[model samples]
Target chain A: MNLTAEEKGILQGAQGKGMQLALSTLVRYGEAFAADRMVEIHSAHLAGSFGAFIYRTYYDAIRLMVKEGLKVKVPATLNPRPLEKIKFLDRIMISQQGFLEASLAKLGVTPNYSCVCYDRENIPPQGAMLAWAESSAVQFANSVLGARTNRNSVTIDLCSAVTGKTPRFGYLLDQNRRGQVLVKVKAKKIDFPALGFLLGKKVVNRVPVLEHLECTRDDLKNMGAAMAASGAVALFHIEGVTPEAPTMKDIFDREPDEIITITEEELASLRSFEKSKPEMVVFGCPHLTMSEVKTLGEFYRGKQVKLPTYFCMIPRVRQELGGTDLLRDLEAAGVRVTAQCPLAAWTIRALGRKTILTNSGKLYYYLHKSEYGATEDCLKFSGVSS
Target chain B: MKELQGRGIISGQATGKALVTSQPLNLTSGLSKPWNLFNRLAAVYYDRHHELYKKDLYNRVLVFPQTIGSTFTGMVILETIRRGRAPLAMVVQQADTLLTSGLILAEVWLHKKVPLIEVPDPQLFNLIKTNDLVEVNGDTGAIRIIG
Candidate 1:
């Protein structure tokens, strides 16, 4: 990998054990993606699920690391979940109390109710390297910030932070970030969530180039959220939308690999709403933002989701709602103001092996194609259980 | 098969189950409580009820792109590890998640250390199986399933 002498020295443990572990992890991650070397990340973002597993595994690590005197130096922020509360509530649930909490104390991670971590912290220099994990963050960083990062997992984000490098792969490579398949939109201004649902359903397990629509950073953020919720698109290439698409010719890292068009009718079929009474209207597969909830609340006033609906917004965002009495209004209207994500709490409760209603394509696809094959629809409705 | 091998990471030599996944996991929403509980309550649920979760039935090898989700997942994994209920070792496609945190903690705090192989090869899938004795080489990003 392209490493400066100082970086090489750090990799060789001249920096310290923490830096050594971090560098080693980065080197390995880069090699896995077939990248030869590392790149420096201007900023870092901490990630955690709002469930029990995080307490069990990572919580313990942070505790031990803190006890050992490890710390993060670069300016870093957190994803939009409340880790402290989960730690406090579940502390007694496990036999080892101080084990995980101490580690978190050491890491100094914040529960800064924000999804746009780089924007929130105002970190990541223009065209800088990054190691963010959240899909929307990845999309925004690569497409908006002109910053470089391969779509990474939670584990490697730290590695990049510690080592100050990431493998040059996926979105980091100029050749890899280009638009592969072309996607056309028929709607005048494609609704953000529906656009994501349509894109995900059409490009299940594959990459495609998006076209025929005007989108802003906000619109793309919404698209990223919906795409992650409805399908498995960790990264997406939008023509004239993402940073890579400054021009049509530049849309493809190579010549246009392929193209696909989307229509309103095709978008409609993706919803799959059932005819019978709906069971639930679930939101926040990628986890809802306060702005989204507030927007929805305006339409949903005095009306229940017309079915049982669960919404899991970011904990920090939930805190904002608490001050505004939004939670009270939401709950009084019969909606659960969930601070934690349901998908993150897969170990807490079962959604049953039954068909569920949701506007999220990512959740629908995951549940529908899950082991039990629970049926799902975009339109509000019910179906016979298997 | 051109094989690569290293010591097991999370569970020690578990045999009889195999599931390989290289898809990256986002912890914030992908893994949750009841699912972790489900993983504990119903072993068979891995296959029929929770395919999104890598099943460890029949044989005992679980491969992932990497461990994702929360740090607390390490504890649940440790609980399963203490009970001998988890897979033999975790072959992570990458090396960044709480998987390493859990392994380090089990080794240090809990005094239970399991091998966690960080192999980054996208092609490691070709050489592993549900019933084969596999070694994970985190150093080289490869896996060798012993016949």
Candidate 2:
């Protein structure tokens, strides 16, 4: 890869050992992909913050960097941990969380603790380059916001955050971002998450451009998250919806490589709920935005929940909604509002086996069979159980 | 003996029993016991694949099409290696950055080696089956099947 003189200097150990190590790691990563150059990144969002005890090495590695006095050059945000300080963890979990917190604190990273860092922490300008690690966030940044980024891994994001640079390849190149397949939406009411799940399975790493569908920002967010979970899709174009692609022609330079239409039946087929009663209902796999929380509050007003329900959001969003009448009403309805990442929280063995109902397709895909019970979405999950 | 060539993501050499799968593995949840704390065994909860669920991944040749689920997969790979439970080498139909980043971290920080090679050939999967002894040359991008 072509490196600037400064990058070469850092590589030559002109900078600290931490910087040298960071650049060397990135260079190897870039070489694996045959990347020829490095691009400046506007911002970065890192994962691996949960510090789950099994990942002690990750914490130790970061701690070494911190001890070496290496700091992030660009604005950086962290992914949510299992809990902030709920105090239910055993001795081992507590120790792991402590190590993770200390390492991040020493690095001076923002305590955003959100997968949706683009929404709350830092919103890059259109076409701005980024090095973001969270799957859903990377897809949203690339597909919805028109910003460029690859589905960076946790360590790569850390390196990019410190260096403010990433290898210029894959999604960073315009050629790889063009729509490879054309998908038409034929459903009356768009199930954004299901649509995303379907698109991801169909495309499998190829970029798809949606046609003849109108979707909101939140709709795109849900769709992108599910797509990233089900497939390796980093970026997608929705004609007349997303920023970059105003029309089908704008997304694809020529006729799309292939075309697929999504019918109402196809969308319906994606929903398969076998559980009769749900032990828990969860929302916000991508972390709820303020508007989503408000809408949920309005929907459940004066209605008592039959099962335990949890509303997960980032700390900032929780703070914004705290002490509000909406929050109070939801809490009164027996809804538990916490900033914990449900994905990580469910992994706790203490939770045990229980059927979980959620609105997030990504959550459904991950936790369906592994947790010893079925996982379904709220809409269908509500019909059969409640 | 059969040999296949592709791009090499990490450079090293090793031979181990092969465990091949057509489905993508979610290394983060598939190979982790973060909740168990004291349990050093990874992926004890991964039930998606009956063949791999709760199976030992330590020093085996993990063969798969690609990786799916979670950006934390890279971190999981690193942790698995740190616990001495990582695959001896990885052979994938298509190489992804999420898996390679972990191997890269191991090499850079820990001086440990877990070579990865991509064999995009469709027949490559048909040729290499579970329990087959396979040798990998990451620097040369070669995979030799030896009985």
Report, in order, each candidate's fnat: 0.07, 0.77
Per-residue lDDT tens digits for candidate 2, residues B56-104, read 7667888988887678888778767777767899999988878888889
**Candidate of highest TM-score:** 2
User: Best-fitting candidate, measured by lDDT?
Assistant: 2
Candidate 2 lDDT over A1-386, as tens digits, reads 89999999999989888788888988888888889988889999988777655666566668768988888888989888776555655444545777777777778788898888878678988899999999999999998889999888887788888888998888888898888999988978777888887888788778998885776787788889989988888998988888878977888898889898999888877665443456667888888888878876675666676667778887798998878889888887777888888877776634456777676778777775321122235622333231
Complex DockQ per candidate = 0.14, 0.68
Worst 10 residues of 1 chain B by lDDT: B41-50
lDDT of 1 by residue, A223-257 (tens): 76556544445567666656656566777656655
- Output candidate 1 Cα RMSD: 6.9
Clash tally for model 1: 61
Give DockQ: model 2: 0.68
Candidate 1: docking tier: incorrect
